[model samples]
Target: MSDIQPRRSYVPPAVRATSEWSWRLLLIVAGVLAAAVALQTVSEIVVPLAIAVLLAAMLAPITQRLARVMPAGAAAGLTVLGTILLVSGLFTLVGTQFSNGFSDLTTQVATGIEQVRDWVRTTFRITDSQFDAYFDQIKDSVGKSGNLGDTATAVGLTATHFVAGIFIALFSLFFFLYDGPHIWGWVTGLFPRAARARVASSGAIAWEQLSAFVRATIIVALVDAVGIASGAAILKVPFAFAIGVLVFILAFIPIVGALLSGSVAVLLALVAHGPGVALIMLAVVVGVQQLEAHVLQPFLLGRAVSVHPLAVILAIAAGSILAGIVGALTAVPLAAVVNAVGKHLFAGESKGEIEQELEENADKDPLARR
Candidate 1:
C-alpha cells in the first residue's frame, strides 16, 4: 500500500469531527434517558429525599444559628419541632375557619345551584324528568364501568404512600440538618480522587442556589398569601383565612398553583356574593400576582435563582407532564440548582471568584453570614 492506501475516502476534517460528536451526543442522550427511567422507578424514596433536601435548605440558617448555642442535634430537633408547630397551627386555623364558614357556604352554594338549574331549564327547555333521566344515565355509565373497587384500592395506596413519604421526609430532614457536612463529604468521597475537589465545589454551589431559592420562595409566598387574603377579607369573602392559608401553601408551586387556588376564592365569591364581587375578587388575585411577577420576584430572587420566565414555564410543563403536581412544584428549584452547578463546573472559576460568589449570596441573605 502506498503509505496508508492513498486516503481511501478523503473524509474532510469537519465531517470527521461532526461524526465523532454525533455519537457522543447520542450516547449522552441515551444515558440521560436511562437515568430518568431509574429515577422514576424509585420515585417514592427519591421524592421524599428531594423534599427533605428542600426543607433542610429552608431550615438551615435557623439550625446553624441554634447550633452556635447548642449541639447540632438539638438545633435540628428544635427547628423541626418549631416547623411542625407552625404548620399545625396553620392547619388548625384553616380548620376553624372552615367549620365556622361551612354552613353559610353551603347555603350560598345551594341557592346558586338552584338559580343555575332554573336558568338552565328555561334556556334549554328541559323538564325535570329529562334532567333526572340524564343523571340516571350518568349513574348507569359509572356503575357499568365497575371501577369503584379499583378506585378505592388506588386511594388506599395513595394514602399509604403519603404517610410513608411524610415519615421519610422528616427522618431525612433531621439527618440532613444534623450531619450535613459529613454526609456531603461522604457523598463527594464516592467520586474518583481527581474529581473530589470539583465535585465538592459543585455541591457547595448547588446548596447555595437551593438555599437562596427556598428563602426567596418563602418570602414571595408569604407576600402573595397576605395580599390575596387581605383582599378577600376586605371583600368579606367566606373562609378568607382558609383561602389565605391555601394560597400560602399553593404559592410554593409557582404560577399554576396560585392561579388554581385563587380560582377557588373566585368560585367562593361567585357563589357567596355574586358575579360583581367575584369579578372584583378576580381583579385582586390578578393584581397580587402581577405585583409578585413584576416587583417581589425580581427583588427577592435577583441573580441567585435567575431562571428565565420561558425556562420556568417549560420546566413546569415538563414536570407536570412527568409527575403531576409534585413534579411541577419541584421543577423550578431543581432547574435553578442544576443550572448553577453546571455553570460552576464548566467555567471552573478561580478561588477568588468562588469566594466572591459566596460573599454575594451571603450578602443577599443576612442569616448566611457567620
Candidate 2:
C-alpha cells in the first residue's frame, strides 16, 4: 500500500483577497477618509463633545470612588456642580479684577504711547511735515474704504457667528456629560462583533490617555499661573490678578500661548512702570517658562504620556491648518490619544513569536517550567 498524506485545506481567492495587504491598506484609507468627512461635518458638535468627554474622563475616577459611598448619579451630579462653582468663582474674581484694571490700563497705555512717540520725535528730529504726510496717507486710505453700513453689517454677522458657536458648544457639553458613555457604547455596538472588542479596547485606551493629558495640562497651567502671579505681585505689576488669570487660560495652548501672555504682561509692565520694569517682567517670564519646560513638565507630564516636542508642534500646526484656534486647542490631547493607542497596538505585535510561544507553553504547563 502507498503511503497517504492528508491534503491541506486551501483558502479560496475571495478569502485571501479579504486579508491581503492591498485590501487592508484600502480599508485603512477608507476609514480615515470617513473619519475626516465626519469630523468636518460635525466639527461644531465635536468640539464641545470632545471637551466634555475629556472633562468627564478626568472626573470619572473621583466620581466612581464617590459612587461607592453615594449613588453613581448623585456622584456625577455633585462633581458637575463642584466644577461649575469652581469655574464660576474663578471667572467672577477675574472679571472683577479686569473691570477695575481695564480703565486704568487703557489710560496708561495711551499716555505711554504718546510719551514714546514724543521721545522718538525729539531724539530722531522727525518733523511735523513727516507726521502730516503719514496721517494724510492714513486718511486717504480710510476715505477709500467701503460703506460704513457694510462694515457694521459685517461686524454684526461676526458677532452672531460667535454667539452661535458658544451656544452650540454649551448644548453639546450638556449632552456629553449626561449621556456620553451611553453614546460610546451605542457607537461600538454598530461595529461588527469581531471588531467590537478591538474598538472598545482602543476607545478605553484613548479615553485614559486623554484624561491624563487633561489633568497634566491643568496642573501645568495652574503652576504657570501661580508662578507668574507671584512674580507680578512682587514686581507690583498693575492688573496682576487679571494677568494671572489670562496666563492660566492661555497656558492651555502650550508654547505659543505662554509667549503671547508673557508679551502682554511685559507690555503692561512697560506702560505701568517703565522699560526697566518691562525688562524684569520679561526675564521673569523667561525663567518661569524655562522651569516649566525643564523641571515641572518632565516631572509631571513625562510619565503620563511621552509625546515628542516636534510631534506636539506639528500636531498644533495641523490643527491650526484644519480648524484654526479650535483646532490648535484640541490637537495635543487628540495626538496623545493617538500616540497611546498606537503604542499599545504596535508594541504587542512587535514581540518575537518565540517569546510568545514560550509564554503560551508556560501558561499551559506550570509544573513543566520547574
Choose the strongest candidate by TM-score: 1
TM-score for predicted model 2 compared with the true structure: 0.75
Tens digits of lDDT, candidate 1, 1-370: 4576554778989999999999999999999889878878888888888889989989988988998999989999999989889999999998988888898889988776666667679989999999999999999997898678898999999999989988999999998888877787788789998776566667777887888889999998898899999999999889898898889878878778888989999988877776678889999999999999999999999887898878888989977776668878889999999998888878967766665665665433322333
Residue 27 Cα positional deviation in candidate 1, in Å, after optimal superposition: 1.9
Error of 1 at 362 (Å): 11
List residue ranges in candidate 1 displaced over 4 A: 1-19, 114-146, 350-370
Q: Return the top candidate by lDDT.
A: 1
How well does each candidate superpose onto the true structure, as a TM-score?
0.86, 0.75
Clashing pairs in 2: none
Candidate 2 worst ten-residue window by lDDT? 361-370
